[model samples]
Target: MGSLVASRPVYIPLSPCPRLPAPCSSWYSCSPYCLLQILVTFENLAAWGRCLCAVCPSPTTIVTSGASAVVCVWELGMAKGRPRGLHLKQALYGHTQAVTCLAASVTFSLLGTIVSCAGAHLSLWNVNGQSLASITTAWGPEGAITCCCVIEGPAWDTSHVIITGSQDGMVRVSVSWAE
Candidate 1:
């Protein structure tokens, strides 16, 4: 006769508290089980959100402020426990309405800068959370900024340009001197 064997089960708990504020619009993670970023959307407040924290390895993590809320990079791994508090590095506050989009520069290592787009404006910021520069849109008649990107040239000079897709279905591209 064959002997019977038993199997064991494992369990994991859901987040104890709401990880995001009201109206979380988007989120991204950098690695599996390691880092996380979240975007929250709100109304009539600051009109924009801020990146809360970057996990260890410094610049490998990037955060962006959007029209409705802030966005962060997320990773999947052993949860390191909820962040107690996040330090504010830089802030791009000029738009009267919500910031709609954000984008970071392609990082080569753990220490690099990120560029963000907010409602027809583009801002360059450092890893330590300092705003290098903020420029308004030059190419479009704007009410809200929907998206942005950082383009690098052959000479390593990055062109900080923003393509804002408006509610009116128009796309406008603007260049920033901050780049």
Candidate 2:
């Protein structure tokens, strides 16, 4: 039998939570991945929970948990031909619960992105970092988004829509673009 080898797992600590009793979780990725967004859930006095968001050329990597929304924007740049440390660009907030799932697409006119929350709400953010609109009953009162995907719509249709799966065992298709 061949021997088994285990590699060390990379550990990256996230920003500290200002207030205690409120847990803070974070996730991030570095260069060569094409995506650099962190999902952080930390409670503050003003906002119960906030998710930082940033838009890049194309999002290729995203780390999320439960209904926690994606938070934090870090731009990975090179200095002296070496990759520099990540810096906080901005913080995005728009969900009450954890972000269950989110996706980006270019198939439609200006869909940009779709974010689903465990609270059964869906939000559309444009490429310019503007919130186009939000829907409270994206799935239904009993629906909790579990997963989602974005793809080109029917061949005859010029626009595209977002497809989602929820805890209610229902698959939903909804418009992504804002008026």
Candidate 3:
């Protein structure tokens, strides 16, 4: 009889830190995913749930969505070439379905501006645990929002447009002028 062999997974290291592409100098460190990477992983409890989408608005902060409708904001950082791990800062609640999309403005004045979409609902938030604005549309099941992007107007102008796409092949445009 032949003996059974156990299989193991291979780990490949990602090295994107050193490579700073061209336009990064004009926009700071956002070229390489805003200079943030999940270099090290800390164990998340079962209650933490599964991350659906994640983004880093700044070096010291990360915003993430899960399989549930709740949104989580985490504090992440490094210390002496070592990962400091993730710290739960806040849990945002409002959506009735899983948040599948997220976008953060890259402008300097609006560094913490975040937009997250779930089902037909869109919400605007700041990294400091504030809900700026929210809107819900009766898009039905086929009109679930699938993607979104933050279009920053100007440093002095608070008015901006939020573009979103849906599963029903329709595009949505929303405007926000609040802080």
Candidate 2, 113-178: lDDT as tens digits? 535445588766654456766786554556877676666665555454777787788888876534
Each prediction's RMSD to truth: 14.8, 14.6, 9.5
Quality of model 1 by C-alpha lDDT: 0.45
The list of candidate 1 runs beyond 4 A from truth reads 1-59, 66-97, 108-113, 138-142, 177-179
lDDT of candidate 1 over 48-136, digit per residue (tens): 34332222323324354544434333322223553322333345444454445555555523234455555556666555555677666
Q: Output the TM-score of candidate 3.
A: 0.72
lDDT of 3 by residue, 9-106 (tens): 44343345445665453234533344333455555434756778887766777778868877887777568865566777888987778899988877
Ranking by lDDT: 3, 2, 1
RMSD of 2: 14.6
CA error at residue 83 for candidate 3, angstroms: 2.4
Against the hidden reference, what TM-scores do the models get?
0.42, 0.51, 0.72
Candidate 3 regions exceeding 4 Å error are: 1-38, 107-111
Ranking by TM-score: 3, 2, 1
TM-score of 2: 0.51
Candidate 3 residue pairs in backbone clash: none
Backbone clashes, each candidate: 24, 9, 0
Q: Which TM-score value belongs to model 1?
A: 0.42
lDDT of 1 at 128: 53
